[model samples]
Target: MGEKRLNERVLSPEEFVSGYQYITEYLKAGLPLCDVLKRALKYFEDQFVDSYCTIMLLNSKGTEFVNGAAYSLPDDMLEKFMHIRLFDGLGTCGTAAVRGELMVSPNVHNDRTWRSFANVVKPYGLKSCWSVPVFKPGTSDIVAIFAVYSKYSRYPTQRELDTLSAYNELLGLIVSNYKIDDSGEIEQLDLNEDDNLNSKTLYVESIKTGLKNGEIYPYYQPVLKSDGQELHGVEALARWEHPEKGLVPPIDFVDHAEEYDFIDWLDEVICRRACEDMKKLMDDTGKTFTLSVNISAVHIRKQNFAQRIEDILDETGFPADCLAIEITETSLIDNLTEVAVTFQQLKNLGVKIAIDDFGTTYSSLNYLKYLPVDTIKLDKTFIHDVDKSPIDRRICKTIIQLGSDLELDVVAEGVECDQHLSIIQDFGCNIYQGYYFSKPLTLEGWKNYLEQF
Candidate 1:
C-alpha cells in the first residue's frame, strides 16, 4: 500500500474484492460501453475517493476514444483526451503498452517518463498515474486501456492493479458483443443504449451536421503516370475540416458516419462537391479528366440510390463520362440481383463503377465478375509493397490481368516511391493514384498546381 493508503487506513481485502466484483457485474450486465466505463469510474472514485479514472477502448480504426457509456468527461475536452493514443512513448498508457508492464508515476512534473504529455496532466492538476492495457479475450491484441489519475502525487497500491485486471476482461466482452462480423457494413454501436434504435437516427444527424458545416471538403491527391513525371487527374478525397476542431481525417470518422445510415449523406455531399469542382476545373483549365467518388455499401444497398446519383449529375451538369462511382467489395449485398440491375442502369447512364479498396476482402475478385463495373482500385497495401515481395507482385499482375480481361481500368492507390511505380508500370498496368504523383490537393490548390506545371 502507498503512504496515502497507510495514512487513510488499511483497506480490507473483502472491500477490495467487492469493488472488483461490482465493476465486473456492472460491465457484464450488457451495459453500454460508456455506462460501463462510467460505472468503473464511479466505483473507483467511491472505493478510493479523490481518484479520477478513464477507460479508452479501440475505436473501429484502432484509434482513441474513451468508451462513452463509461466516461462522463466533458464533451468539449473529450476529443482531446480520446485522441491520446496508446503507443510506445506516446503517454502513460502507451508507455505501459510498450513495456507490457504496469506503470505508476507519482510525479506529473518531474518524471521523465512520457514527458511529451505533461501538458495533458498539467491542466487537470493531476500528478499521479496508473495504466494497464486491457487485452482482448484469449488474444494479446490490446482492446482497451484502463487508467487512473489522481490530483495528488501518491502512487497506487497493489490492490488497485489486481482489481483493474478483472475489470479489463469484463470490458473486452462488452466490446466483443458489439463487433459486427460484417466486414464493411457501418455498425450502429450505441455504447450506452443499443436498445434505443433512435440513437442511430441521432448519429445520422451528427454526420449531417458534419456535412452542412463545411466539415467535409474535397482534398485532391495527384495521380501519376508510369514515368512518374507526368500528372494525370487528381483523386478527390473527402476532407472533413471540422469548424471547432481542425481536419478530421476519413479514417477517423468515415465509418462512424456509415454506421448511422448517413453514409448516404456523405456520398451526397462529396459527389455534389466533387461535381461542382469538376465544372470549375473544366472552365479554368479546359482539361477534362475523371473524378472517382467513393460510395458506401449502405447507399448501394438501396435500389433507388442510383436515381439520386442521376439527379445530382443532372443538377451539377458535370459530364457523365467524367465521373466514376467507387464501391467496396461488400457493397450491394443486401440484394445482389437488384444491385446488378441498378448497375446496368448506371452503365446505361454512362456512369462507371470501380471496386474501391480492392483485395482487402477475399470476395472482392468474385464480386467484380458479378457486377459490370468499369474499374478496380487495387488497395493501398498491395501498391505499398508491389516491388519488394513476390506475392505482392503476383497480386498486382493478377489484378492487372483481371482488369485487362474485363476491359476495365485498374487504378493503384497510395503509390509513394520509385520502386512502387516501377513494379506497377513493369506489369503493363496503367492508371495510378497516390503521393507519388502528389499529395491530395485542395480544390483551388489542385487547380493552381495543375496549371503551374
Candidate 2:
C-alpha cells in the first residue's frame, strides 16, 4: 500500500481487536519474546507495506537501549542501534526515551531533529519515522519505544497513528506482564543488573564520577621475549584506584562501565594514555616499542572507528604500527562484518591486531583464517596447566603451530612459573606474559623494570 491509501483507510475495529487477541494468545502460548515481536511486526507490516518496524527497550538498569525487535533493517543499521544511551536529542527512539514523548520526523532529510543523525539513516533510504515512548501502565517512566519507518518521506497519517496506538497497547502489555517459556518456566525479561544489584548501582555511579575525576587509569604489564628476557611490549590494563576502596581490580568496575555503555570512554582514555607512554618510550630510549591496548566491541562496530583511532594517533604522533589493539574472542560474535572492516582499515594504517583470550569464544576458526589479525594471545586457561596436563600442553602446541602456519605471532598468556614458561617455549611460543615476567605495574615501576632490561 502506498502512503495515500495508508492515510485514507482506517483499520477496521474487528481487525485491530483480532491482531491484539492473536498477540495475547501468542503470549499465553509461551512463545519467545523475539518470536512475539516478530509476529507483531508481521501483523503491522501486512497492513503497511514497504515500511519497517522496531522495538527498543531500556536495559534493566536504565543505562542503555537494546533492540527488543527489529524488522526489515540491515545489519549495519541494526548494529548502529545495538546500544543507545538515553540522552537528549540522540535519535528518534533515543530522544523519545529521553523525553518520554512521541517523536515524528516526517522528512528525515530535512528534519531538524535528524540533523545530527542523517548519516546513519540516509543510506538505508529511511525517509520518515514516527516513534512513541512505551510507558509502564501506572507510571510516566518509559519502558520501551515503539517506532515505525517509511521508505518515502511523509508524515504518518491518522490511520497509521491508530495502528500505532494499537501496537503500542499490545507492546505495553507484553512489557509489563510476566513471561513464561515453552517449558513452563518463568523467564526474566531483563538481564542488566550486576551481582550485587543495588550496591552495583551505587558502584556504577561512583565509576562515572571516578572517570571524570581522573581516578581510572592505565597500568602497564610487561610482556617479554622468552628467548632473551628482553622487553617486547606492555599491555595497557585499566586500573581503578578508588580512594576509599584502595586498588580496585578490573573485574570490579569494567563490567559496570560496559553495562553503563560508557566503556568506550574508558577505552579511549586508555588508548590516549598508552600512546602517551609510547611517545615517552620513544623520547627516553630513542627506541620504538609496541604498546598494546584492549578495545571493546563498542569501538569496533562504529563505521568511523578507524578514523577515530587515526585522530588519536595523529594527536599523539604514535606510529600506527607501534600500537596493537587487543580484542577478546567473545567480541567476534555479534559484529563480525563491521569489525573486519575496521580491522582492515587499522591494518592499512599499520596497526597490529591481536585476539586476546583467544580460544574462549564459541567462534569458528574461519575468523582466524579470514579476519585481519596479526597475533593471537592464547587464553590463560590453556597455558595455566600446560606443564602438568598433557591435554593443555597439546592444545598450546597446536595453537602455536596454527599461528605459525598463519604467519601470526603467538603470545602464551598466564606464564607464571618456570614450568609454564618452559612448556610454552618448548611448544614454539617465544612471546609470553603473566607474573613469571611481571605483574601489571604503575608507570614508575614499569620504567624501573625497563631499566633492568
Candidate 3:
C-alpha cells in the first residue's frame, strides 16, 4: 500500500470529546499547565499519526512566547520557538500570534515566513505547519499559540482545521485559567495551597534568588589515581551556601531545580564558575588539572548546548581539552541519538565526555557503543558492596574489563575504605573518586587541600 494521506485522517468527534474530557479533568485536578498541555498534544498526535503538536505560552509582557510544551518535537527545535516575537512573516506560530488568526503553511519549503526556521525543522522531516492563536477567555488577546506539524506536505482539511479550532478554544481556557510561576509551577487563579506545597514554593523561589546572589557555587571533589593517590582530576559538585541555612546540600535544591526547569540556568552558573575558578587554580599552582563538571540532562538538551560550553571556555580561558562533561547514565538513555550528537559536538571541541553513575541504568552498555564517551565512572552501588557481595565484585570486574576492551578510563566511585580500593585495583580500575581520599570541598578548602597535597 502507498503512504497514508494527511487529509484522509480526520479527528473524529468521539476522539475530540474524549480528549476534551481528559484535559479538563487534568486541569480540574490541578495538574501543571505544561503537563496538561503535553497530555492534550499527545492525544491529538495519537489521533493524527506522524504529526506533532506544541503549545507555546505568551510571556507576561506579551512580547514573546515562552515555556513551550511539545508532544513530539525535539528540545532543540522547541527551543527555537521560545522567545519568538509576535510578528508577521516570522513563522507559522509567530505570525498566528501576531495576526490572532489561523496560519497555514501547506509546504514549509515554499513558504516565505518559514525561511528563518526552515533549516531547523527540515532535519526533522517537518514539511507542513498549521498554527492557531489561542486567545484569553472572552478577550481577543492571544495568550498562547497551538501549532501542528506534519511530515507530509499537505494542508489540513476543513474537518481537521475545525478539530484544531475546537482544541484551540480548550487550550485558551486552560492557558487563561492558570498562571505559571517563576519556578514553572502552575497554579489555578483561585486555588488553595497546603502548607507543604507552600514550603516547596518558597524553597523553589529561594533557589532562584540564590542563583542570582551567587550562593549556589561549585565544590570540588578530587579524582585520584587508585594506584598512587595522585590527583588526576576534580569533579565540580554544586553547593549552596545559604546565609540562614549555612550550607545547603545539592540533595535539597538540585531536584527542585530540575523539577522547575531551572537546572539549565543553574548548570550554566556552576559550569562558568567552575571554569573560572579552575583557571585561577591552574595559574596559581603552575599545574594543570582536569576539571569535570556534572551537567543535567535538562541543560544538555538545549539548542547549541556545546556552543554554550565553548562560550564559557572562551570567556574563562579554560582549555577545552582539560574539561570533562560528566553526564549520568540515565540522561544518555533518555534521548540517545540527540545526546550522542551533543557528545560528538563536545568531542569535536576536545572536551572529554564521561558517563557518570555508570552501570546504574540498563542501557549503559548500549550507550557505550554509540556515544563518544571518554570515561566511565562506575556507580557507587557496585563499589560500595564489592567487598561483601560476590555479585557486585563480579559486576565491577566485568565493567573494568569492558572499559579496558573499549580503551576507556574506568573510575570507581565510593572507594571509601581500603577494601573497596583494593578490590577495584584488583579489578584493574585505576581512577577513583570517593570520601576516603577527600570529600567535596569549598573553594578555599580546595586551595588549602591542594597546598597540603
Off by over 4 Å in 2: 1-198, 362-364
TM value for model 3:
0.63
Candidate closer to the true structure by TM-score (higher is better), 2 or 3: 3
lDDT of 2 at 134: 74
Best by lDDT, which number?
3
> Could you arrange the candidates by lDDT from highest to lowest?
3, 2, 1
Query: Worst ten-residue run, lDDT, model 2?
Result: 1-10
Model 1 scores a C-alpha lDDT of 0.66
In order of appearance, the predictions have TM-scores of: 0.55, 0.61, 0.63
Candidates 1 and 3 compared: the better one by TM-score is 3
lDDT per residue (tens digit) for residues 1-453 in model 2: 111121123344456556766655555566676666767777777767568887766665554665567767653565565455566344677777776677888787787666767777888888988887876543445667777888888777676675665455346656655443322233545433312333443455566556656678889998889453787788999998888888988888887666555577778878887798768777997866789999888757755778878988999888888899998888788878888888999999999999998877668486686689889999999888888889888888988999999899999889888888877788788998898778999988888888877
lDDT (tens digit, per residue) of candidate 3 on 350-414: 99999998998889889898999999999999999999999999999999999999999999988
Q: How does each model score on lDDT?
A: 0.66, 0.73, 0.80
After superposition, which runs of candidate 3 have C-alpha atoms over 4 Å from their true positions? Answer: 1-196, 226-228
Question: Can you list the residue pairs that collide in candidate 3?
Answer: none
